[model samples]
Target chain A: MTDDSIGAFRDELIDSGLVIDAGVEGLYGRTLAYEEIVSGIIALTTRTGAGDGAMAVHFPPLIPRWLLERTDYLKSFPDLTGSVHTFGGDDKRHARLLALVDGGHDWVEVLEPAEVVLRPAACHPVYPLCTGGPLPTQGRRFEVQGWCFRHEPSADPARMLCFRMHEFVYVGDPDGAGAHSELWLKRGAEMFESMGLDVDVVVANDPFFGRAGKFLAANQLDDALKLEFVSPVSSTETRTAIGSVNRHQDHFGLTFGIESADGEVAHSACFAVGVDRTALALLKRHGLDPGRWPAEVRARLWP
Target chain B: MEEEIRQILEEHGRLPVPMADLDNNADLYEAGMTSHASVNVMLALEDGFDFEFPESMLRKSTFESVSAIEAALTSLVGTPVE
Candidate 1:
């Protein structure tokens, strides 16, 4: 969609009292009505994946900065990653910072990089747990949910600085990983359809950064490592990716030394749902009010 | 040029198998070159050849094989010096 139309849609959302203008382009506060939809969508996801025997794991939004450095994330997406910073100086340094602030000059130099970084994806923190060991014969599965951060700020309402993600992760041999990704690819599509949203599952890639990333992105596409479930939310012409399934072929396993029962490096895959985007998509499809949604959809969600 | 390419791959490709066992057309990535290794290989090639790869040449096909790397380098820096 055109930039102007996207802004108009954001304005419409604000006028409807569904979202509050936070003054930031990509950051918004949700009303009770908007939050209710979000909660309902998350509950639906939990129910849909309940039969998978995946152990539920919850994580705070922060992880160690060293763990992020150990992976290839910095090389692939330096532009989108966010590291935490804090003012950890002596009293003299604080005085200097205040003086800089008083003079209306940049005061960022006073802050130092903290021990943690904002979690980039829901499944990221789980990788370290699987490290330095071999998985069981049946492999491992986990259901994780957390708020993820990316530095991308845009006019599009779907692209937010921070959003909640619900992910189902599997770490095992190549065949198991492949099967896990395949199973979720179908289930994700079906779940969206049952919610009354017409979605398409298509091959996709991460937005790798810079000149080197072009080739890396092509590599990912050629290997069919990623798939996205997209539907028109803010605009029909440009669809938003509401969910994705990614196959990391021994990438994390090698980085973290995670092995299979037979001692081979484990492959990993995850299917993630963007909770905020899904709520937005549902609102766009059914209406602004969730109370008036189709009986079937409401039953599936609220029940 | 082929030998030089093999040398760079040996140092940076991170392939499990020996480079001597592979043919020119063998897919480097399939042979165990990770995405992180590919970035290193790209940077080393630019340094070794003293030429920067244009954005168009930055794709998997351009570095999928020893021959593909040769072709890409030749396009960027003309015929192989060797």
Candidate 2:
């Protein structure tokens, strides 16, 4: 869609009280109506994955800086990662910081890099926690939900700087990890379809940066490592990726020294949905009011 | 070009088997080169050849084997492989 149309749609949403204007691109507040839809999508995931022996895991939006450094995410997506900063200084520096702020000068340079970074993905912290030991013989499955931060500010509402992701992470042998991703690939699509959303599972890759990143993205696509469930949240001509199934292929296991029951490096995969994006897609499809949405779709969520 | 490519692979490919045992048509990924190793190999190749790979050539097919790397380099340099 054209920029004007996208902006018009966003204005309609704001004017209708679905999304609150935060005065920042890619960062907005959601009204209760929007949050209710987000909750409904999360409920669908919880209910559908109940029979899969998944354990619920939750984390704050901040993760250790050391762990983020260990991952190759920085190498591939340096442009999109967010690192936290804080005022770690003596009283003299503190006074200077306040004076700069009072004088309308640059105060951010006085802040130091903090030990924590904004969590880039919901599943990142889980890998290191499972290290230093062998996983269960059959493997481990976790249902994790948290706010993920990516520093790509854009005019597109679908591309938020901070968003919620409800993810199912699996770690174990190659076959188990592969089976988990495959199972979710079907189940995830089915859940969205039942909720009256158009679902298309397509082979996809991360938006890697630079020339070398092109090769990495190509290799990822060549291996079919990432698959996304895209729907028309913004424009039908360019559907937004509301969810994804990704295969880590022992990258995290090798990085964190995680081992399987057989003493080999474990493989990992995750099925994750962008809860906020899904909510927007639902709003686009079913209309603004949940009470007026189709009965079958409401039944799928309310049930 | 072929020998240089093989040397770069041996240093950066992280393959389980020796590069000498593999044929020019052998798939390096199947020979145990991980995706991380591929990035290193690509960087090493750029430094060794003194030429940057174009975005179009940044693909698995371009670096799948020794012959493929040689062909890609030949095209980028616009000269016959030595």
Candidate 3:
């Protein structure tokens, strides 16, 4: 059985007659998936700094180890961090690794795809920086659009291993925490609704405790993972979680000892908009017919 | 204390454990307890008690088991465990 989402996007790509990766195999699909996802991320990031004076920052796709360590990333998500490693030996070892890359798969596992592990979630990169900087007396907030990686071996294209994460952060605000989350939630709804996806708000939980996540999953529930916007795709409740209004609830703030004007520690929240799947959901929602949908929306995205 | 921890585990989908016999030096990591689950437990603890779990107390040994969590909660609440 195929998910209606991947099926819908696949069909639309076929109908559009765009080049789908001709020789691709398995669930990753063809060219259209890549084009649609990359293009979708491009379109979303281009819309920021619109009237809110939002400054954008794009960090390295592979975050440094020290940075993740400071935020106790391993403690919270050891299961997710990808560690960068290599053969620890003399220059001969280094040469062997290089030979593999140049010789096209030779020299054994010498270059052992060591990692400065690919970032699992995008927000961890931002937290330590916020801690190091001079934050707002009230709180400093910024939005970043990042490409994140996960070890999801699931074949679902929607659950692709490499996906784009669009997350906005409201940091440093101690007393104004609730106000920030509320504002982001309102902004997120307008964006998803405008994209023409039938959106539904849900309270979700993080995928940390595999079994403990049952409450969120039993009825399609997630833990304190307060999810507000899910758009209908195949039928109804099976809609994708295109966007999440996350209240990191000062988890980051508390981790870093981020403080308000008086120097009292503050908490912060994040609103993550999963840009890639959201675009897929939008395409599914609008029938992937460019002509049938409003040209202005398309023009804004394409333009 | 063991019963309280069991209730949290049962209600929260966390792994149940026998923490009464578990001492401070006991190896919690080898006992099926994980730091990832500890965060969930922390969140559950917050919701269960309507109080905040300070990040200051999030050290490795803090969430060793049911007894440890109860001790932390007891300290935060300024009272002995029932």
Model 3 per-residue lDDT tens digits across residues A168-281:
777766456677777777877777666666787878645543333332233223234366678754334476677787665545665565666556555677778777677667
Candidate 1 deviant stretches above 4 angstroms = none
TM-score-wise, the better of 2 and 3 is 2
Clashes of each: 0, 0, 21
Using Cα atoms, each model's DockQ against the true complex is 0.67, 0.68, 0.06
Highest DockQ scorer: 2
lDDT of 1 at A220: 83
Residue A23 local lDDT, model 2:
76
Query: Stretches of candidate 2 above 4 Å error?
Result: B1-7, B14-26, B70-82
Worst 10 residues of 2 chain A by lDDT: A3-12
For model 2, residues A1-303, the per-residue Cα lDDT tens digits are: 897767776887889898887877898898988888888899999997898888898999999998887777887899999998999899999999999999999999999999999998999888887787899898888899989999998877888899999999999999999998999999999999998999898888788988878888888888899999999886656788999999988788877888999988889999999998898888888887789999999998887
Residue A176 in candidate 3, Cα distance off native in Å: 2.5
After best superposition, candidate 1 residue B81: deviation in angstroms? 4.4
Each candidate's root-mean-square deviation in Å? 1.8, 2.4, 9.7
How many Å off is the CA of A149 in candidate 2? Answer: 0.6
Which candidate do you rate higher for DockQ, 2 or 3? 2
Candidate 1 per-residue lDDT over residues A195-244, each given as its tens digit = 99989987887788887888788878877889999988888678889999
Q: Candidates sorted by DockQ, descending order?
A: 2, 1, 3
Candidate 1 chain A: worst 10 consecutive residues by lDDT? A1-10
Ranking by lDDT: 1, 2, 3
